[model samples]
Target: MVAKRRQFITDSILLASSAVAFPHVAGAAQSKRIKIGQIGTAHAHASGKMSAIRSLPEIFEVVGIVEPDKERRKKAESAAAYQGLTFLEQDQLLNTPGLAAVAVETEIEQLTPTAIQCLKAGMHVHVDKPAGTTMTECHALHDEATRQGKTVQMGYMLRYNPAFELLFQVIRDGWLGNLTELSGTMGKYANDATRKQLAAFPGGGMFELACHLIDAMVTVLGKPDQVTPYAFRSHPEKDTFADNQLATFHYPNLVATIRCNHIDPFGGPRRAFEVAGEAGLFQIQPLEPGKVRLGLTQPHGPFKKGFQNVPVRKTTGRYDDEFRDLAKIARGEKELAWDSKHDLAVHEAVLLASGMPIN
Candidate 1:
């Protein structure tokens, strides 16, 4: 049975890679400039995403920003990225004439609520990672967006990453035969201030960082039968945050583990994901400027059996493709790549993995 499965996967890899290699390109003529707004700047990636949206003048026009926290607004105003951006109250941004979409970039606690408000206001939203702390609120927002036929694009950046896109294609093509084990590690050195910021969440580093890998794992493996989380505060610092954590996801056919830490000496180059299967293995390190290494049982297509470095298209930047996709969905040029069902499942898995209460 295993041999047959391996053969099947090897055969399918070619077909899968072909389909993913040539995705439907969004056309310039069909592109419409989407009038967008941003809500909150407390999330770490909020300013970066806003700046990215502002750069894409042809596809998006960021009309205004809604930041409720005076302190947070003041901090953001000092950043060059947020400079010159209109600051409006939440209601004003939501009620702006011809508003087409909103980017929900609030602190983790406020993500779902703000997204729900945007959906209620008849605007599509790009809610950031983990989809907030609660499953109920995330579901409520997703359901409302579904009922209104609006898009809720989760800010899981890797979904738009070219390297991950190639990895997904390889898996779908059966090039990796019967995925047995998948592992990912994401970590960084957190300073006193960053550690304090992360200490606010129970899951700490895992909640803030590993959620990215969890999103990718769930995308490839779907919902797991069980998620076992091991959270720890390995640092000597006097903080209650769980600075080191690992979550093992058990599925019928696959067992995956994700490890995250806030104090890795070599975290930058060590950030990586690996997939091991009956027929092959694939690894990507330094997930940002993604570099992939592929291994097969035998030579298949352009890849050799032992190992080979796979090259992918250069990433324009983190948020460029994501905002472009959002604009396309807002303009009715294409349906959302991820639907409410997928987002809901991903959020559920993330909460479970992060050791957060789902109810």
Candidate 2:
């Protein structure tokens, strides 16, 4: 049985690897190509998401892109991803014939409102992160999607990371007897230009970065019973952005600590998450490559009782699997794993962590 269980671990690893591009999704070759239009290119991930969508010609038909800002549109249209795509007015693109989905990749301020527009137009939307400035905005976007029977796939980049996927498995299958601790740090250096942009919001680095960690934390331990936030300014004289930030989430059994900062000149490689429970511990460092270190208290499944590095497939593109899943959902092949309820929970946690008002 140990032999079988050991091999099962290998099979599990393969399962996650295959989901990178959804290369192994059943009937993908026959997937009804969902006509998808993109709105705006101001968000950082806008072009990347469009690139991923266009790469999957078998799954998504690029109906057109809508960017009202002439400067941004002209700048974006020249990009390789938008080179051959059409540019339409917002209403024109939203009302395109047979349009089934819209990727709401507008600016952070417009993310929720634009997604709400698409939802009210009877379209499923793949919205980029932070949801918006207010809990009310986030709730309205999701509430409209629910009323319209459409899906709202938020752009939480790490949802499909192989190591994080394994973490989900560990939590779900009781590999960890009971999740007791979850902690992560997400940071990146922001230049003057970026800092100026982010300084508009008090959440600062936490809102811009740690939302991803909060998404993962909420997955491991649902809505935090209480969220305690510590927001500080690393460069007080330069900007009002809360560049240095930490939020501790309290749950019935798990306490999750999340930190996000914009002053780490070398923080990218330091991005990491650690979790511990009664039975084992799992850690992923440099989350991009998803290097996994797992320790089991006793022999559990394929993992032996000591700390060891496990091979996890690295992602080719951060948003590839996400758009792939969006297509599958539009084609009625599957449902969103993180639904509205969960997203609302994550959003509320984000607001609390950033010390933004939920009301």
Candidate 3:
């Protein structure tokens, strides 16, 4: 149990390494740019996802967009990312000729159902996170995608970050021998409106934000043998809002901790993940477009002993690499890096950690 828990690279080492070696060119066949569309501009990341797709013009062509809600559509229409792009009704966009894939960026609850619709319409999908607040929709969506022979890429962007890419290799190679403890913090100050929005979900802070780190945790540690959750409130006068949350994941010889809060003014810069092994310590704070710190007992590869900095290449934006890879998978040039089974494992862990009902 202990050995399996720390085996971060259970998926093919090539699957793990391809992230570091991103922009991996497929066999001699040259594939054309995939024609893609966006659905539902209400999600926080909807515009950003659209922008990322447009940025990779070499990999994808923006066919059109779908935003069902009139108010949300009106707001998104004027956003810089959506300007000049045609906005069509849901059916029109899904039925567009040559529509190879869709970015399902609906409001949190609609994410899975929207993606499932695209899959049924013969489009691959990039659905955003938490897979919704429960397991039922997530299961149905994955089942439909599998039945349709289409890819459903969850919107967890950290998997492609260069720092995480290298860290996976370090731990997998036994550079961090015998992982003993791991902890991560994800938090941001949220006002009344935000808290009320996130509170609708069972885990509130942890479900809304910490799920990102939870995805990272399960990626490195696998699902915890058991997870003990602590949910409490820091909201001034609200009782239902779990504004502060923590989960302790139990393993045979390892312990992992995930903490999230809606009350950190410095939370943006404080977001961090740290791993402690007998041989070394690896930490990344403010974890996106990641900056890393490494402490080693002895030199490993080109990295020196003691605390040394690992150079992370400049990231144009977090979504660029994922969308580029999405294009390849949509074009049949490559297989999905992390498959449906892995995605379900991550969501199961997320629900467990968030104190949400699994069903």
By TM-score, the best candidate is 3
User: Which lDDT values do the candidates have, in the order given?
Assistant: 0.81, 0.84, 0.82
User: Which regions of candidate 2 deviate over 4 angstroms?
Assistant: 1-25
In terms of TM-score, which candidate is stronger, 1 or 3? 3
Q: Estimate, for each residue in 41-127, the C-alpha lDDT of model 2 and write its tens digit.
A: 999889999998988887789999999998998899789879989999989998889899999889899999999999999999999
Rank the candidate models, highest lDDT first.
Answer: 2, 3, 1
TM per model?
0.91, 0.92, 0.93
Better of 1 and 2 by TM-score: 2
Write model 1 residue lDDT over 1-359, tens digit each, in one string.
43343334334333333333444534433545789999989888998898889888777888989888889889888888888989999999999999999999998888988899899999999998878778888879888998888998889898777778778778867787878899999998888899888888887888788888987887777777899888988765678878888999998877899999888888879999999999999899989899999999978778888989989887557887788777767877556655676677777877787888888
| Cα lDDT of model 3 by residue, 1-359, tens digit | 53454452434434634553654444234477789999988777788899988887877889899887889888988899999999998899988899999998888988988888899999999998879877888899899998999999888887777777777778878887878899999898988788778878877888878888888777788767898899887654775788888999987778899999778888889999998899999999769758899999989998888997677777777688778778768877667666776788888878888888889
Largest lDDT belongs to which candidate?
Answer: 2
Supply the TM-score for candidate 2.
0.92
Which ranges in model 3 have alpha carbons more than 4 Å from their true place? 1-29, 236-239
**Position 211, candidate 2: lDDT:** 96
Candidate achieving higher TM-score, 2 or 3: 3
User: 273, model 2: CA deviation in Å?
Assistant: 0.8
